[model samples]
Target: MSNMIIEQEPDDELYEHYRFEAGKGQSPLRVDKFLMNLVENATRNKIQQAAAAGNIYVNDVPVKSNYKVKANDVVRVLLSHPPFEYLLEPENIPLNVVYEDDQLLVVNKEPGMVVHPGHGNYSGTLVNALAYHFENLPLNSSERPGLVHRIDKDTSGLLVVAKTEQAMAHLTKQFADKTSEREYIALVWGNVQEDEGTVEGHIGRHIKDRMQMAVFPDGSQGKHAVTHYKVLERFGYVTLVSCKLETGRTHQIRVHMKYIGHTLFNDARYGGDAILKGTTFSKYKQFIENCFKILPRQALHAKTLGFEHPVTREFLRFDTDLPEDMQDCIEKWGIYSKSHTIEEE
Candidate 1:
């Protein structure tokens, strides 16, 4: 939401801002999220509250949080309009529901599943599934509907969805407030020295590569990111660790681990496991011997998520076991990671 806000001080002491309402041929979208798209400077939290407070209108009718909008529905607001393409459409995809109510839907996202439709993808995303399920959430917008937060495409874990404006606002506010908790499990290439530790750095886009991110201090867009981790088990050269995210950003865990000198096994983009093949982890030679032994990508999984229900206001927590491939590697390599090393340059 903070990212959506635009800072405009004053102009001629009486500033003029643009505004518009959804019209026919447009699908229904969340009122708050709608304004987020229409008004480039408005936060989802702000719009959600505004809509809840009856500041938004669909065809001159005041709608509630979950109110479904129709195509070409008039959407009126009190702010200037933006011109960013926000196109999230519904597709028929299967979803594994862990919990659902009138307020939201919590689903177990599988590995390699893209959460949103963008760039190379125009369909086959979790957003499509949500659209299909909710049949056009209160977006009243043209871009991105029924989405509050996101996980990496390759990372598997629980994702919460907002079915209504109130639910979306509460969950998003919780993320901003740092009350909702998200923890992940990773099978790193080497063992950590102590039992537990934390990684902190300012994260932003890599200056050399627009597609990738890098760690920097006092950057223009980079923000502080932190991860708390404790060892779960040890292979001579490898270790299983549990990590909790203090802040969410693109590739935060992978980048932080690589920066700290403990990259995930087989993670080619970072410090890969090639070094451990003939050295330190000699005992795991046979373990890596089998073709299916080592996992393809860096082993990381979203294991736990906890938050207070937006509708019921009751605390809820969920957990998942480690993926099988990671478990196999740990069984063979844990407890013997003597070769794992972090050489700070």
Candidate 2:
């Protein structure tokens, strides 16, 4: 909440900009971090704002805000022309509060509302809303406050948030230890060959691509992933299943479902039209195929979550009803089921 700025003339800004230098063959650090270290005079929030809005540049190129300094990566930061964006601005977005205590908060995140701010998304996030609600919520990570773990941008459901710093540390530890019970509901194409089973495999980065993840036989350095699931209901060809994570990894449920025979309906990444080719012509199946128009993303939701309260150490649990799009999909499935059965008979 300080307004101190460090501006410099274009020609002479080097070396002493930060208190610490790239020690002996090490790369330079991010401008904001370096500036924070050099002079405790200016607040870090001011420096970060300057860097993000292109007031700071690396090698005269407006580099990514996350760009770490490499050796000779020309560092030029102009704190004088700081963007007037505050570190924490409260937006009056409505939040669905499932449960709230002094220690933590349980929220039902709607589909398409991102959990936190990222590169292209800086506003309208769960954290943004929480910041608005709680005056000064502390976070596990310095950058992200009040977040222990996160659900995907499109996956709607129960999210546990820590309100206090002690709670944040404890809840984060639970997630890391896999003691946090995270349960999800997914509607996948076709009935799984087995009614109950687990997907156990090592997951790692896709060999060919950087943006996506894949299950490799020889698997990379990524940790072991396991998802335990049982059928919740069967709607004609589609099977609704309850999934619990034995091990949490990025896209663990989505990747494992696709690795097995059945993939979630409208999963553009793992489940493409190849599987849909068999299900097309069915009104419900086709609706799911063209689901980009109907639903925000795949038919997946973190429906339930349970964890030991960081402060109380008491077992805490919460659940959320399926979002509107999911309800719509279920209705279409029912309609398709009735007609398809009569035609077969």
State TM-scores per candidate: 0.67, 0.70
Error of 1 at 284 (Å): 5.9
Stretches of candidate 2 exceeding 4 Å from the true structure:
1-89, 272-292, 341-345
| Per-residue accuracy of model 1 over 161-228 as CA lDDT, tens digit each | 88888887788778778898899998776557889999888877555543356788555557778889
Which candidate number maximizes lDDT? 2
Q: After superposition, how far is residue 60 of candidate 2 from its true place, in Å?
A: 23
**What tens-digit string does per-residue lDDT give for candidate 2 at 265-339?**
777767543445334456544565555456657889998899998877899888778888987877777776667
Candidate 2: clashing pairs of residues: 19-38, 139-145, 139-146
Which lDDT value does model 2 have at 244?
A: 98
**In candidate 1, which residue ranges exceed 4 Å CA deviation?**
1-87, 138-143, 218-221, 271-294, 334-345
